[model samples]
Target: MKTMTRPRYRLAIAAVAAATALTACGGGSTGADGGLPSNVSFGGGASGAIYGVLATGMAEIVNTNLQGVNARAEATAGGLQNTRLVRDGELTFGLTDPRVVYPAVRASGEFADEPPAEDLRFVMNGYPSLYQVTALDPNIRSIGDLRGKRVCTAAGIQTAMLGELLTPYGLAVGDLSLSNLEWTECADRMKAGDIDVIGYAGGPGAAVLIQAFAGSPTAHIVGIDPDKATAMSAQFPWWKPSTLPAGTYDGQTAEVPTVEISGGTLVTRADTSEELVHQFLTALESHFDQFSKVHPLASYYSLPGTATNTMSDVLPTHPGAARFYRDKGIPGY
Candidate 1:
């Protein structure tokens, strides 16, 4: 048999933990030693994606540090799916964005098919999911420049957010020839001159952006003009102003102004035991130094940032998480 690396071995252990935890997805059973669940099902993002990697690392940390709690990260279709699963109690914990959770709370936008997930509770903050507007045409300096150009917005959550982004410029998705392709396909089309622009959202060093930028010399990320970014943030409170500093990517020598969702909010049901949530936060805090090594995006997180901006004001923090932060004197909690 081939030798499995340490990471792979950890994930294999988590897979077995997941199988044992499946029956407990409805709401976990308390462990004998503590009020915390004996098994935990954490809904992570798409398989092989960055969010998935973060979720896997988190579970590994918990399993290694938090005795009596078995945490398993399960692959999911990203935030939207994770939100629904968490709301319905099919997942004990989930990773998602405040933007995605906000709409689900109101039962609007992509979540219109289901009732409002009013019970969703924010546990912790992750990192920014900044929108990177890239184009192969150097002449496309601003969003307005793509009036009649072919644009690919990826699809689902991204398509909706990008459509909203165009509104401040007096442009709509209909104004451009739109394609709902996947990020990989968008990169390919952009390279082939089939698409004029790509609207994608992810952490700074997202893999798809790296692929798109490397494939075409002309492909470069464009900044959202300042006024538009401000207006968009005003209209969508979940968005925060962010700057993509110079040299963030190869050949990109200047900073770019952008608006991003404070993504990676760890959410759970409101009824989750306060002790359990507190214990969960404790486990994460103790392993903070090692987390960045597990995933680079985690480096963006800080106690102050997490306490104040993990989720929007509209979403309430669980009492357990709130207590944990308060005890640590993390200011905004």
Candidate 2:
């Protein structure tokens, strides 16, 4: 008979020991202990997408600040998926858009059973997303001019927000030939002359919008009337008046006023320890410049109560986060 494989048996035993150690350590592998809950996974948008980049930066910040906590970022579809994962405890944190958050909490929408995501608490708010309207027809200089044209507003939360924004202007889906297209599809359709107008809601520096504007020199960004924007804001409390500063995109010299909404919020489960959350916020505040270097958008992350323009939609601040805000006398929930 062949001699027993002593070396192989020893290797097998070592692997088992490692696995058991991981399981015994509160579902987290042994690493630097940051006085945090445990190892955490962050969920954001599609790979290399805006939210994906933001999530990656956040993970880096958290890992650097906390000991023993290995935070990893993962790519997901978008807001809706992120919210669901957080609710199911599949993710410790995530980045989400406000458009998706509102519907998720509403009684008539997909998250009716889940009700208000009471467990969902905000970590940070990102920049404003403008509703950009570009029309091929020279005569279509405003929202009213698209009455009889074929228009494409990318589907999902964006399409819904567009409908809400246009209703008071007496424009409805029936008023225009509508095409349900994604952002990339809408840009291509506009370039191919398949669509007369494209409505997009995104951050000021969306690549697709930049390309669309560059490709179609004749295309114009229809100006939204201030009164109309005000009326819409009255209907949707979350809507805010925002301006895309001059030169945000080529050939756009004058500041363009538009109805906007905040996107990209860092959220955590309600049960996450306050001490851990406090440490995370303190580290973020202390390292603002580091994150800003990582992503220009992160420049907005700072002390909550400062006079600098800041978003107020962060509804129920986490206890740990609230402590930091209160210490600064920043009004927060």
Clashes of 2: 5
Candidate 1 per-residue lDDT, tens place, 253-274, comes to 8899988887787888887777
Which pairs of residues have clashing backbones in candidate 2? Answer: 32-67, 32-68, 33-67, 33-68, 34-67
**Measured by C-alpha RMSD in angstroms, how accurate is candidate 2?**
11.7
Choose the strongest candidate by TM-score. Answer: 1
Encode model 2's per-residue lDDT on 233-317: one tens digit a residue.
8777667777777787777778887878777776767776677777777887888788777666666566652212233343456
Q: What lDDT does each candidate get? A: 0.78, 0.69
Please give the lDDT score for candidate 1: 0.78
**Residue 110 error, candidate 2, Å:** 2.9
Candidate 1 residue runs with Cα over 4 Å from true position: 1-24, 29-34, 310-312
Candidates in order, TM-scores: namely 0.87, 0.81
Off by over 4 Å in 2: 1-35, 303-314, 328-333
